[model samples]
Target chain A: AQSVAQPEDQVNVAEGNPLTVKCTYSVSGNPYLFWYVQYPNRGLQFLLKYITGDNLVKGSYGFEAEFNKSQTSFHLKKPSALVSDSALYFCAVLSSSASKIIFGSGTRLSIRP
Target chain B: SQTIHQWPATLVQPVGSPLSLECTVEGTSNPNLYWYRQAAGRGLQLLFYSVGIGQISSEVPQNLSASRPQDRQFILSSKKLLLSDSGFYLCATRGDPGTRGYTFGSGTRLTVV
Candidate 1:
């Protein structure tokens, strides 16, 4: 079955430090990878996506993800963490053939001031 | 600018009660719509999706059902609510023939008592 995985349940980083939220995937064919952030009870907000071409995809809120085909990973990263960036981050894979998207278990990011 | 709207930002319902959640999209046509549930702020579970009117495909078999009465309108319903159904429900949309990521609604926080 096609699936996305966020190995870490939580990631902690000090404010202004570089942070990374890891993600991996198992799927058939080329994958359309994406990252999303959720704040409390609000709906998810799209961060970035990798459809084709460039491996490094930048998205909203100063977030970017590196899509590594050989490793089957699309990890989210930020040059500098912010307290406001603390939230639930999810990695997803879109199956165009199946016409649906699968999400990972999410990683809770905490940035301490 | 594509947008998704989900109603009833928060809802508290009793067990065995009927449930209905609505989602609509704007600024796009022939869009693919999806319903997802997040349990305890964790991973997202794909519930249902619609490629077009009257073309609902369920990702998981559960007490819930979905309908697309119009091109841009999607609705999720349950005959009887279950305690396990309480969570953050989000509606999302992706444009057809496009590689962009999905746009999600603000989500509905449902609590079953």
Candidate 2:
């Protein structure tokens, strides 16, 4: 079964500091990885995805993720974090042949001003 | 240009009461629809998904049920709501084949007392 793991439950960072949220996935075939952000009481918003080609994928709101095939990781990163960037981040993986995507447990990102 | 509309945005229901949540899609046709529940504003738990009208696939067996009567309409219902069902419910649609990401609705905050 395909699964996604987000190791950190919460990450705290100062405003303007770099931030990283770790994610790892396990799948049988080619993996379609995605990152989503959710605010309190709201649904998730798509951030980025890695389907093929580029290992470093850029996404909405100055976010980027690196897909490491050998390590089975797709980590979300931002060069400079902002207070508005604080939210719940989820990493999901979908196999090409699968019908649905598998989501990670989620990581709470807190950016202090 | 795909969009998902889920309502009522917020809901309060007593335990054992019947519940219904509706979701509709626009700017797309025959798209895959999904229903997910987020507990405590954290990880998402996929409840159901459908590829076409009248084709529902359940991921977890619980107090909720989903139906797809129209190509763009999806409904989540429960005969008797439980206290545990109180959470944020999200409706989503799979994006185009090239993107392979999901576009989510604004979400419905359901509080079952």
Candidate 3:
């Protein structure tokens, strides 16, 4: 079974500073990775995905994630985070043979001023 | 332009009550649909998925069930709701083969009273 691990339970960053949320995946063959954000009572919104080429994938709200095959990691990053960027973040992975996307334990991002 | 919608946005039910959460997709055909649940401040747990009409695959064995009666519609139901079933329910759709991440719906927040 394919699975994703978000080692960090929470990440605190200063506003206007760079931020990162770490993610690693375990799977057979190739893996498709994704990042999503969820607010208070809303559902998750898609941020980015890595299916094929370009190890560095860009996503919404000025977020980007790097897919490292050797490390089995797809870390989400942002050059500068806004106060409003603080939310719950999740890392997910999917296999070709799997119909459902497996999600991580989630990382709560807190942007401090 | 594919869009997904889920309702009602928030529901409060008593224990042992029945549930019928509806999800529908527009502007997409034969899309893969998924249902996921997230506890407060936790990651998502895949509940079920569908490849086509009347085709459902359950990821976890629980009190919940899902059905895809229409090509672009999916419903999550349960005969008797439990207190453990209170959470945020999300519906999503993937566009093509080899694609994993998805377009998500607005989610339904269910609180078992």
Candidate 4:
């Protein structure tokens, strides 16, 4: 079965420090990977996506993700962490064969000031 | 610009009560509509999706059912609510396969008592 996995349930980082949220995916054929952030009581906001081409994809809110086909991972990263960036992050992949997008079990990111 | 709207922002219903949540997309035509549920501390689970009017594909078998009577209107309904159904529900629309991420609405919080 096609699936996405966020190994960490929570990741903590101090403000101004670099942060990473790990994600791995299993799917048939090329994968369309995405990252989304959810604030308290709000719908998910798209962060970035890696469809094709460049391995490093940048998106809204100064977030970026590196897509590695060999490792089957698309990890979200930020150069510097911010208190406002603390939220639930989800990794997703468009499963073409299943005709749906599958999401990982999310990782809560906490940035301490 | 395309926008998706879902309402009501929050709902409290009694167990066994019928439920209706509506979602509509603006500034887009014949777009793919999707319904997703996010339980507390969990990832988004796709409920249903529609490519066109009257075309609904369910991702999971559950008490919830979805209908698309118009091109841009998607409705999620349940004949009877269950305590397990209380969660955050989100509506999303995808336009142009080239688009990287789906546009999500501001989500609805449903609480079953």
Candidate 5:
């Protein structure tokens, strides 16, 4: 089965510093990877995705993710963390030949100001 | 531009009550719709997805039932809501299934008392 793994349950980062949340996926064929964020009492918001082309894909809220096919990893990254960046983050992989998006266990990101 | 909307931003219902949650998409057609639930401090669990009207695929078997009466409208219902159903409910859609990413609605917070 296709699945995703988030190595960390929580990540703490100081404001103005770079942040990374690790993710790894397992799939049969090439994978379509994604990252999403959810704030308190809000629905999930799309952050970024990797379909093809460049390994590094940039997304909303100054966020980006690197899709490493060899390592089967797609980790979310940000150049500079902000206090407002604290939220729940999820990594997903579309597994089926049809369309099936499977999400990983979420990671809570806390940006200490 | 495309947007997704979910109704009843917050709902507190007693156990054994009938429940209904709605999701609608605007500015798009033939969308692939999805329903998901999240418990507090956890990741998402996909409940159902639809590729077209009157077609629903369930990811997990539970008390929840879903219906898609129109191309861009999806509804999740339960005859008798369980306390375990208390959580955040989210709806999402994609223009096409395999190639595109999903856009999510604002979400509905259901608190079963």
Candidate 6:
């Protein structure tokens, strides 16, 4: 079974500081990883995805994620956090042969101004 | 550009009332459709997926059911509602491998009392 784990339930960061939301995965083969963000009472918006190529993948809204094959981790990162960037983040995984995508427990990101 | 629409934006129902949430996609064809639910402060739980019309695969056993009567139409229904079923329901669609990523609807907030 393919699964994703988001270790932190919440992450707090001061504005202008860097922020990280940790994510790890378990899959039988190479994984297609994606990160999504959700604002209050809204649907999730796609931020980025990692299919192949460079480990560092940049995404929408000045966000990026690094896919670490050795550590089986795909952590979301931002160089500078903004108060408006605070939202719920989810990490998801899907193998090429898999018909469905599995999502991890979400992490609530809070940026204090 | 592809767009997904889900409604009603907000719904309040009694414990035993019937429930139905509809989703439709535009500017695409033969897309893979999915239904997901998010409880308070939790990640997305995939409920059902459809590869084509009248083809639905359920991921979990619950009070909800889904239907794909048309290529761009997906509907989630329940014979009777439960308080536990109250949450935000989201619909998503993705094209074949060439598509960039999944597109999500605005979401429907259901509150069962």
Each prediction's TM-score versus the true structure: 0.94, 0.97, 0.94, 0.95, 0.94, 0.96
Q: Global lDDT of each model? A: 0.90, 0.93, 0.91, 0.91, 0.91, 0.92
Candidate 5: which stretches are off by over 4 Å? Answer: B97-100
Between which residue pairs do clashes occur in model 4? none
Question: lDDT of model 3 at residue B88?
Answer: 94
lDDT of 5 by residue, A19-99 (tens): 999999999887889898989988888888888889999999999999998899999999999999999999988854747
Report residue A54 deviation for candidate 2 (angstroms).
1.9
lDDT (tens digit, per residue) of candidate 4 on B10-98: 99999999999999999989998999999885788889999999999998999999999999899999999999999999999874434
Residues A1-113 of candidate 1 have per-residue lDDT tens digits of 68998999999999999999999998888888988899998888878888888999999989999999999999999999999999999898876575777888999999999
Q: Count the backbone clashes (under 3 Å) in each candidate.
A: 0, 0, 0, 0, 0, 0
lDDT of 2 by residue, B1-113 (tens): 99899999999999999999999999999999999998888888899999999999999989999999999999999999999999999999998636748899999999999
* Angstrom error at residue B86, model 4: 0.6
Best of the two (2, 4) by lDDT: 2
Please, what are the lDDT tens digits per residue for candidate 2 over residues A1-113?
89999999999999999999999999999999999998887788889999899899999999999999999999999999999999999999998888788899999999999
Per-residue C-alpha lDDT of model 3 across residues A1-113, encoded as one tens digit per residue: 89899999999999999999999999887898999898988878889999999999998999999999999999999999899999999998888777667889999999998
Report the C-alpha lDDT of model 1 over B1-113, residue by residue, as the tens digit.
Answer: 89898999999999999999999999999898999998888888889988899999988889899999999999999989999999999999975424457889999999999
Model 2: residues with Cα > 4 Å off, grouped in runs: none
Best by TM-score: 2
Candidate 6 root-mean-square deviation in Å: 1.2
Q: Give the residue spans of candidate 1 off by over 4 A.
A: B96-99
Question: Which regions of candidate 4 deviate over 4 angstroms?
Answer: A95-98
Ranking by DockQ: 2, 1, 6, 4, 3, 5
Candidate 4 lDDT over residue span A1-113, tens digit each: 68899999999999999999999999998888889899999988888888789999999989999999999999999999999999999998875555667789999999999
The residue pairs found clashing in candidate 1 are: none
**What are the per-model DockQ values?**
0.70, 0.75, 0.64, 0.67, 0.63, 0.69
Instruction: Pick out the ten consecutive residues of candidate 5 chain B with the lowest summed lDDT.
Output: B94-103
